[model samples]
Target: MCFVAAVVWSLWSAWHLPSWDRQMDLHVYIGAVRAVGDGVPLYEYVAENGDPFTYPPFALAVFQPLGWMSEPVARLVWLGATPVAVVSIAAALTTRRGIVGRRRQVTLTLVAAAVLMVSAPIQSNLRFGQVSVFLVLLAFVDALDLTPRPVRGVLIGVASAIKLTPLLFVPYLWVTGRRRDAMRAGASFAACTGLAHVMWPAASTTFWTDAIFSTSRIGNLAANGNQSLNGALIRVGVVPPERAAAWLVLSALVCAVALVGARQCHREGHTARGVVVVGCATVVASPVSWTHHQVWPVLAGLLLMAGPRRTRMAWGVVLLVAMTFSVGGWLPAGFARENVRLLAALAVCTWGLAPLRHRAPATVGLLPGVRLVVRPRTAMAYAGVVAVAAGAVMLLVRESPVAVRFETPDHRDEALWGAPTNGCEGYTSTLRADGTVGYACESAVDPVGGRQLNFGGGRGGSSGMVTIQGQVGPEVARLVFVPVEGTKALDVPLLPQPGPGSAPLRAPEHGRPEMITSGPIEDRRLPGARGFSIAATSTDHALLLAYGRDGRLISSGGEKLRMG
Candidate 1:
């Protein structure tokens, strides 16, 4: 019942909500598919949302069938697939040897799927129409299946072909003694690449030669949403030169520990736990693991809870994983958010590292049919592998070119307009790089009765309010805006757009413009006002400035602004 309810709610939300806010990523996929069908260059074409095609060319072929359908139908199909994928993964995980009784397994699958559907990551996946859930399902099924080597390899290979991250599982399979499966996975990946080349040779060349290495095409790596170790380091002021080496060392360590733990679990007949451990490692080691990619830890949490012992520690691990998605923001910024996810993943690995105890014949009903067997050679083998892999990675990082500093691209013409300030409250308008404008405003008198304004025009215009355009120069931009209901419009100029190299303009104090260190200047001067001033502390900051009738600063108020 809960699962049904969740699915119903997801479907309803997908259908009723505005297209711009939800299923946006799905629209990208659909656009990519349509581009392929229309013989358009994949990497060059932007989607409706101004995002370029980021997925591999092979993924286009996979989603190409959807191009034939109408957009609404395709969206419905995509949204509907998420719940099915979640349920399928849950079913696959629960159908294993230790989970006794069909009814109990089904119940657990339904409950877990329902709970996960409402979780933050899954909700984010649905909201953005992302393919992370499908990727998770593919990976989990490939890892847990006791099927023949080729089948598992094909699943992992296909997933990796769609998105590069699943390639991590190939090494994992090899380390776990699934060498044949690893070879097959490589072959399958090669086959997919060959197919892509055959299908779209030009796109294949462009993607493989250029687009694949350009990580900036995705977005800002240090943004808060990026939960990877690299992102965390960058957020805490780690320079790019040191960040690459640091990431290599940290990722190598995580990979070694996770693989060793997984091998130990598998040797001890805990295959499910082993798979989950490797999955957790994949997310942690990736260079850009977004929050939606956290489906692995969620799956690992469910698997841990299903274990026979169900100890306080097991439940605690599950709770920690849950908290990663729930109250993650409560922790301080930088490493704190990344640490929450990392710690949960480490806890899952630790669970796998626990010594397995042999079950008596009577107690075999609770455990899997296999007995707990210890093998020291397997440990030594993994230890040797870890040593070699870590050495290779460190060597590569040391020899690789110096990491390039990342810079935010200048969007000088981009001016965000706030709604007409009516007694200290108004709406904010954002101008996207693609020249699209979005406006949302709320009135001070009636907070609930805010109006959303619509403004049109490309990147060029004049100074007057009648034009409602933006005149952006290298240092300053003049933005003219008209009220939603009123005829009068206002021109607000912002000096020096926000970026690394822009100079800061200080707020006027005592009829003088106080110069400050470099930063963006927010000029909120109106036609007639008493005075204005800007104040800044190490942490807290505020700005207040007034203009005279002749556009000269007559008076100033508020605290003096400080520059760091």
Candidate 2:
């Protein structure tokens, strides 16, 4: 079943071949590798797309062979290799103890790989042709191996040399009473770094001395795609100036707690579970963990599934995985973007660490009138149950009633409604019958003078005592306003009008006002009296906001206006 699923997935992925060249991060890696091979100074070269090579110099060496191949061929090879790496990791995790048969081992490995491919993190990794899968496999093998300490350490060292995040595992080794392995891993890491320095002194110097700490090179740390605790706090309205200190304190606390849990798991003969927990903690504690860095949670889920049955931890893992797989349009934009997955990872770490009693073993029939104690049927059963539950939840969320609906204004309409409130407060929009929309947003000041609006998943938000107006056109609504106080008013187009019955409109192209073609106004029931609602996408970003007859600002779902 696993092999069949993997083959189908691979064929489908191959059918979408045009996207191979569009893997931005893979291009960055390829560029660095070519630069290294050509002796053109790796750190000094930037790709045409404005992305800099941010990985360690040794990573260039690791990927150097790809530079020799044509771009298409390299991409195909990389794509194919990812599934192999995923399968390898699964094999190591599932077959290490040698209790399972060879056929069962292969089936389990393929099944694990297939399930992971559906997750958002793995999807993102494959989309970008990232090395995350290979790195994950290396770390998993090192952490779960019962071999000599040096071999385990070497695997982790090689992984760390390619990407700095895996360095977190070295300390994990020490904390879990594997001091020799930790020391060997540290030495191996140093040796690789030293080798890189020898091969490309200039790039090595620049990376170690500056690039390693330059978060800007990696793009916006506070971007919605960054799922770290720091990113979450930033999304929740934490100011930039204090966000670093806040992240430091919070990351420390999370690490301390997670380490304690991981240590417990390690001592309890669940090394794989411990390693997975540590991996999750590392991602959560990092300053900027992209969506692809979240593979650890999936690993934890698999571990729980293959562990003892009828336990709370097992059920919790099932629910967590199910929730993650079910995540989609039903969630608030911000929550859907990153928070939900991050929360799942945190939950896995926490649950894995908790001290829960194991359930009694179940007996299964091996022969006539003969029963043998064994674990729950297999991870496949757990996956099947979760898949069914997730499908049901998705159906319900999709068919649920609209949260808010707007009423179309007749000739003249005047109503006041609060802003679509989420994470921020104190802003309102008013729709006038004169084909005009007015906003009376409170100034970004209360006790402290700063913006209070935390537009989590939206393109952005505005603050301060500001008054802005826009004329609603026959086909498009042009919103003109300055984002900050004392700035000139900028004209921006609203989304194309949506159809009736509260149906969602397709996202409009950015900066293309001509593309803002109008559609029939949705005739949805309002909370109060009859009024028309105009649903439109935000021009600045892929955001959906609706304005109703009153001052109703409806986001993903409509909200009842509170008349003041």
Candidate 3:
């Protein structure tokens, strides 16, 4: 309870914070609900009332209650509650007969902290009003042994229906010779998903058509080019992702084979750590999971340590490194791209199955089953203790000040934009001496280069009137600054053409001529390049130099921002 309390508090402290680089998916779920309440359809082509539903159907269902409350209020409720649920899961699986020893307790504490520190970027989701942990925890409950046979089966099925990723576990259950278990769970899941659909067709329809489609939309995002294995392949070779499905299928098949072997390893009385294998299998089965998504592996690591604490050490170090990099934002865009996230997931799987390396599964379960027996090791094992204790530390330490500074306007703001964040990066808007205020992308952070957006104010939606409050005085005029990425240059194609309501303005950054230029800038066709990039210069000023196809600047003066 103390550990859980600590985690909950940490999350609460981070509540309602906004970050531009992180908190990608978390906002989408909550924002869609707000939009639904505001009369927007789930998957509107033009971002639907400025709320994008880019999550699974079950994700939307989970947010129904949130829709009734204000965004800030809902974020507070979630931040305070979800970590407790996560810790409860850790406790449920690690505690034997509901009794925890000092060593195990410490291990849990460390593991929790480590998760917070390493996956601090995940904190972005929590602060920005996201609900990823719920899905993660729900799926975990499905795999636990706390329920009756029938109830357990349904739980797994329902979890799978919510996020197709959990489907990764089915092969493990089957290979571990839990075929019947899989069927029962599948039945329950089918029923839950069907029931939800029948009861809420609007949400269901939008999820299948819009929300679900949003996830796959990543294939086209330049930011993804840095964050996922799917992106890595296309990036390294400069080719279309032709082998992704095949690779995913192959990985699943391997896990299936491993599952069968792990089952046999269990049946043959190998070792006592099959608990770890089950967890690792879950990770290896998926392709694009993030660090927080891998937290459950700690449970698998604990199970391995419970017996002979051998295999987990190597992988634990590997995992710690993986997570540390993830949270620091030091991880390159290709961090998730290189299958590192998959490796972390695999670490858990290895630990879960470690016991099977020593003894048969039935024998292992029997030993723990005997009410009078106590396992020799109680969490004093070196690696397990470190993992959990580090996690606990994370709960208390708070990420570096830099992390706090990277935040967004608020959770509600992040919620307005889904993944790819769609040119909604940070903003550079200020009232000039001329009285006419200007808005532009926060280029210092490279917001536009990543297919992400960097804008200012408002609920953080692309079109929401950007309202800058407080010290800035009453409210400056709101200018919507959109982000464009990739091409290294932007050609006006046509500049400040005399339009109905659009005005000319100057860019403070380049000291470019103000919107009221004295002379006409040259008009020419824009040169093409590798891709595209976007910048919101004051619509007021004429674009002097346009970035050309060869990555060169063509303009009146020689002012240029080079693409690296």
On TM-score, the candidate that comes out on top is 1
Model 2 off-target regions past 4 Å? 14-17, 37-40, 96-98, 146-149, 311-328, 332-338, 353-564
Please give the RMSD to the true structure for each candidate, in Å. 16.2, 17.2, 16.5
Error of 1 at 496 (Å): 13
TM-score of 2: 0.61
Q: Rank the candidates by lDDT, best first.
A: 1, 2, 3
Candidate 1 displacement at residue 204 in angstroms: 2.0
For candidate 1, list the clashing residue pairs, or say none: 419-427, 427-441, 531-546, 531-555, 532-545, 532-546, 533-544
lDDT of 1 by residue, 178-268 (tens): 7777778888888998899999999999999998865535655656566666665555544445556777777776676676567667767
- Compared with the true structure, all predictions reach lDDT values of 0.58, 0.58, 0.43
Poorest lDDT segment (10 consecutive residues) of candidate 3: 469-478
Question: Regarding TM-score, does 1 or 2 come out ahead?
Answer: 1
Candidates 1 and 3: which is better by TM-score?
1
Over the stretch 260-357, how does candidate 2's per-residue lDDT look in tens digits?
56666776677777788888887888877887788887777777677566585566566446434655445766544557767766666655543322
- Could you tell me which 10 consecutive residues in candidate 1 have the lowest summed lDDT? 531-540
lDDT of 3 by residue, 1-564 (tens): 555555656664574344542233444666666766677555542222222454555655666887677755765676667666656565555443243578867686556543543353345445544554565566556555456766665666766776676675565455455667777777766776777677567877767665564333222322331333333333233222233443354454435434544555555554223434554565455544444455545444444444444555555555545544643245565434455555455544433343323332232222223422222133113334553554354334322111001113332233333332212123444555568655543221121232111122223246432221111101111112112111112222211112212333223333455522423222111121111222232211111232222222122211121110
TM-score of 1: 0.63
